[model samples]
Target chain A: MEIIKIGMADLGVAKPPSRLRTTGLGSCVGVVLYDEVHKVAGMAHVMLPESTLAKNGEPTVGKYADTAIPYLIQQMQKEGASIRHMVAKLAGGAQMFAFLGTNDMMRIGPRNVEACKLALKGAQIKIVAEDTGGNCGRTIELDSTNGVLQIRTVNQGVKEV
Target chain B: MANFTKFGDFQFDVLREIGNIGAGHAATALSKLMQKEIDMKVPQVRIIPFDEVADCVGGAENVVVTVFLRVEGDSPGNMFFILDMDSATHLLHQVTGISKTVQEWEEMEVSALHEIGNILTGSYLSSLADFTQLNLQPSVPGLAVDMAGAILSYGLYALGQTGDFALTIDTAFFEGNDQVKGNFFLIPDPDSLPILFRSLGVPFDGDY
Candidate 1:
């Protein structure tokens, strides 16, 4: 089976006999959207909560939760996946460090999770499973064939949802 | 994204020098702490894509022990002291005589590693502050043993909102002929670049 790799602040979609994978997500979040009927899966490794938070010229669509989710959906739609049949699985918004309270960016892990959930809700997509908000980093993969989302961490081994 | 493409060789040299000054002091402290000579390498300053940042130490999935601290004054940024699994074990063995593997580490081990990071990073920043005449302070150091990508990316989010690329100053450490190896990474926020340049008497705005 082919595994499509998504880099940080990046996204990709895969068809049957393929998997979408992203690794070592700490403060970032990994979001998966699957259309079970069509066997299409999309994954995004988003680095921040909102595109509006960008301080320079706009970053790529996959860099933030608000922008990445919609962009991933649009890409999946173009791949013959229907929005009505889509469901989401989420992982990897971890507070890797203790709360310092001085910089708001230090709390980015939880904010990324909340932002992804809000974006999914705005798109009217149902979230089937999520493994988020912890002090550990995670690597995640989504299989297009069975819509199984697998998450791996340093201490906790692989778990599927 | 802040434009790293426009950076010139002179600007990069400045950054490399900054890394040298900081890590030089840090290495001296480490050498004294371990009572073993620590070898230093010429610093590498680069503007790397977010995905490739973790590749500096190893792959994204590679497990590492990291000491993270936030720099909160003058030129605010992030600092990380990273060690691979084997190096972490060896460091513990050499420093505290704890010959246990990373899996066998307990609270005392964790606290020991955290203090080492704090002392080393504190030395790195104080030396830099003295040289630049800039008020730079580090938050209490935090320690985590996990995937390199996960740990490194925590430092990237502040820059993530501003750009697709991170400008990093990296200094490699090898203790007594590579017995223990580690990496010192200093990633400054984009906004701080100008402040850093100005503090050093380097012109912030000019064509190169």
Candidate 2:
């Protein structure tokens, strides 16, 4: 069992015999793209929603879902994975802040989840499962060999995504 | 109502001082973490009633990173760190030293970002402790999705009140051409508000 642990500001790609995992996702979005036929999987833990916001083009590569998802897809395709057979699973998007008053526009978790869905939809990838939106944080795991996604929230038992 | 107004101003002043000291420490820590010269300005402080935070923060279109901390001791209260996404990602990259072009969003990177939150929240809370002469131990910093509504809602829910006073600090970090903007909110209930004010030596008369 080869376990590839993905880190913040980093992405991991694995082939059939490899599995990828990321933990403690709060506000940040974790994405898993898997091709069952080729037994290939890729995971991205994005901090922000879009790279264009990064501007300067200096560090815009995979920081946002807009850029990260496309890059993961291309990488998977290069490794003999077909987009037609690929499925997406996502987790994380917690609202962890407290505010007082009518200025409640700072809902980054739901926006992130929505943005991820939009990006995936634009790319024509089927989203099979998603565990998102809450006041609590989560951890996500992806198994490449079997294309299984597991999500666990704090104080909440692990469940399939 | 008059008493609440007076108390709000008093608390705001103390929170501003806290934000200044906290942001200064955060900048110093960030400079060390990034191994680059970093500059941060004293945050602009505002004590806003709950219903006007969105307007105060300019509508929250951009990304926001929020950290919730439960503070205990002499001055028991809650503190939140709300940062724009641009600043969050920039700070994340600077602290982690990950190549700017790598975009795969791996799990390790997310873990790395958590360390940034820990540092910022730790430094800020430590400053708060010094200002209020209170013992404040913050929990491990965690990330949350939204900035304005969700964080405020969650915070208020925890406090179980409709209207509360928030100390908001506007801050900026600059390193060469890279810059980031963020805010720190000190949400103390009405009762704790007076205690915080007296600690900071701000007089409260309930006027404006």
Q: What is the C-alpha lDDT profile of model 2 across B52-103, one tens digit per residue? A: 4444444422235666665556665666666665666776776776744223
> Across residues B1-208, which tens digit of lDDT does each residue of candidate 1 receive?
5766567788899999999999999999999888998999999998888889999998899999999999989989999999988888888888899898989989999999999999999999999899888899999899999999999997887788777889999999998767789999999988888888888898657311
Best by TM-score: 1
Stretches > 4 Å off in candidate 2? A1-161, B7-12, B55-61, B100-104, B158-172, B201-208
Clashes of 1: 1
Runs off by more than 4 Å, candidate 1: B206-208
The TM-scores of all predictions, comma-separated, are 0.97, 0.51
What tier of docking accuracy does candidate 2 attain? incorrect
Query: How far out, in Å, is residue A28 in model 2?
Result: 20
Residue-by-residue lDDT tens digits, candidate 2, A1-161: 89887654357789867789875565667889999988889998775676544423255345568878998899899988999999999887666542311223236566668878889999999999888866656667788888899886544668985
